[model samples]
Target: MSTEISIKDAAKQLNISEQRVRTLCRQGELESRKFGNSWIINAESIDKYGLRTAHMVAEDHPAYNVNEKCKKPIALSFFSGAMGLDLGIEKSGFDVRLACEVDKYCRQTIALNKPDTALLTDINKYSANEVRLAAGLGKDEEIDLIMGGPPCQAFSTAGKRKGLNDERGNVFLKYIDLALELRPKYFVIENVRGLLSCPMEHRPHEKRGDDYPELGLDELKGGALNFIINRLENSGYSYSFNLYNSANFGTPQIRERVIIICSRDGVKPPYLVPTHSEFGSDGLQKWNTVKKAISNLTSHDHLTFPEKRLKYYRMLSAGQNWKNLPIETQKEAMGKSFYSGGGKTGFLRRLGWDKPSPTLVTHPAMPATDLAHPVEDRPLSVQEYKRIQEFPDSWDLAGPIIQQYKQVGNAVPISMGNAVGKLIMNLLKGNEIPSFNNFKYSRYKNTSDKEWKEQFSKQVLKHKESTEQKELGFG
Candidate 1:
């Protein structure tokens, strides 16, 4: 399986000392043969040992690069929360050279995991020179990709639909600025689906006896995403934006996101291919259930509830809600909420043992959106949240147990991250058409709540000397 070469030749090829080569061979990190007067090593053995040689291939296999067969591409990530997306992309073969984030806990999480990686606090404060330095490259180093999901609350369905003026919306714009400044070969913009309909400006009302502003959808010029696309196109980047269902990409949760991909070189727009289907014929693959993600986690002993909330979720069977309870019991449990008209689906709900989990929120045990466990009377545990989000068991999350739950709950799932990373890799490799026939987001059974006070206390104690925490007012 390996070509035979002399020890001196192998050392010369690998650009290392013969002593080092011999040491590696002695330790079995590399294999060699001794024939009468000389030592010979196999080419395959050199490759297996990842020894860098001038003539032979010293880099990773072409198939291993997600960019398909192109040269190894480097990346820079922003708003890198717990680095779930970055982790997946790195696994898929893109070299993430540097990361940017503002949250203290998230920064801690990134430091804990990727200690060797260069991490900066804020994208706004980062300069091109600093970025180059952090990447350990010169100013002319080729940056293949820049990816990020700016906070979407400003463009979320629940927030005020203020487009570019909202501070958070400006942050998204800042990400655009960075992209233009860096001019990476590829760029990604991620946000909530509400960006499709969020208004740019409020319509003015006709002059009346008393002056007051009138608001209507027709009065707005366009959605936030329209402006975003226009800006990207104007910057000389050919781009495409679409709504992607995370379920289609192997995440158990049915989370949908608006993702935009842009390229500076005017290449074909990359579309992610799903690799798993919930109800497909292959049968070798199926949508992962909540149980599959979390069944292995040990249950927590204490059933802690949020502060000042005497109400706790009453355990129920699968596919059952508050309506399943005795009529009198329902009325007593729901109180005034029972008298309300709309479908109060959150009341007394239990996750099915076989389905995917619903969208996880900051607090899982809120009365209006109760996510009680099927068998247990309490909410889901902190470890369970990480599993549902596809975070590795060995991954360490910072902050108190409650804050950790909140951070993980708000993250993009790792399975979906992996799919996106692979797609980006394909783009880097010049794969024009990628297969995505298998993505599906299936529903499953899944819960959490501890009080803000307790979580804050724990965070303060946990990061008493954190400089970023003090600067960000998180202290």
Candidate 2:
């Protein structure tokens, strides 16, 4: 016997009702033997017949509280760093009743922002029961969606690409487990693009030799994404995943992420089509420009500029890098980097007055990756960073000024979140999908705000100028 389970246990384990499990047993969808007056199922049969859906496990079935109407769905957030994703989801139109995050700083941040929603201290210490209590629903309530992107450090291209074996990578797996336990209708897993090509370990053959590489402290013995997908499929869900650029979804910065959508319902998995394009074509809109995002804000004193560096950037023009500097000044200002290989593009780089900004990393003043204001001579301040990233002015971030800058810079843009939120709302409401595949927002619909109209119109004019320049073949 390979860990036999009762038929009722099988039903609970698979996140379905006992009545359905009994039917499966009768119809040969499940394997069960009579024990006492009831049927008992073995682990093998459980694996064979059970469906593993995202966000809900067999244990979570008891905690489900949704009725057949599937009214308001509760969300369970995992690896909830700074709650950027959660904020976007909420803004778009879902209720986030509970969140699980491990970092003390992030937790404090969450508490500051959303004091009423139940938040778990550590993801590992939480179970489905805890989630239900926090969500203010019973085990029988159906959680509509489970969402989160575990910390992306281990899976990022900038990092070692350690995949599932990294301790941080294990949190990704734990997210899957919670989804299965909760049996939510859908789940969204967000990660970096590197997950598509991360090298993973093969499932070991029972009798095979043990020459595998040393696994990390809590890393799983398989490729991170693959292991996560396999477990979800085994538990009974269909998943669709792809990489998307934040700029395409109205974010001012050029950031890309891989979004994985999973569902238990046997339907086409929802995919997010691009809503903003770099260049308009076939009625698609161009990407949002950095100027459109932050041009209006009055310049506050920048946070990082020492007196000397600040004076230097003041001399540069928007869209000009060190290459535009006088040859003598370039050598003197750039120092060793002037002789370095590859495009030291960031050296003295200034944002183009008409184009979207590059990704904002933790530090803006980093050599070879300067993010100086187009007109000002210094790196952007915390307020400006938040404005560019689309975070509300009222949203509070906890930390020192630099720490605040880092957190805000690391955040997913609010506009991108809004886009994702709209799509999610449409999906949950069973409405016709919005025009996501099409990218230009300017021509879609007119807004009534005079200032917004003026701002957006100005960018259109600048974009037209750039287009004409391209037509003339100007560099």
Clashes of each: 17, 33
TM-score of every model versus the real structure: 0.71, 0.70
Candidate 2 CA-lDDT value: 0.68
10 residues in a row with least lDDT, candidate 2:
52-61
Q: Write the per-residue lDDT of candidate 1 for residues 36-143, one digit (tens) a residue.
A: 765678866664344222123322111121222345578888898888778777878887777788876676676666655677877777777677776665678778
What TM-score number comes out for model 2? Answer: 0.70
Query: What lDDT score goes with residue 24 in model 1?
Result: 76
Q: What is the clash count of model 1?
A: 17
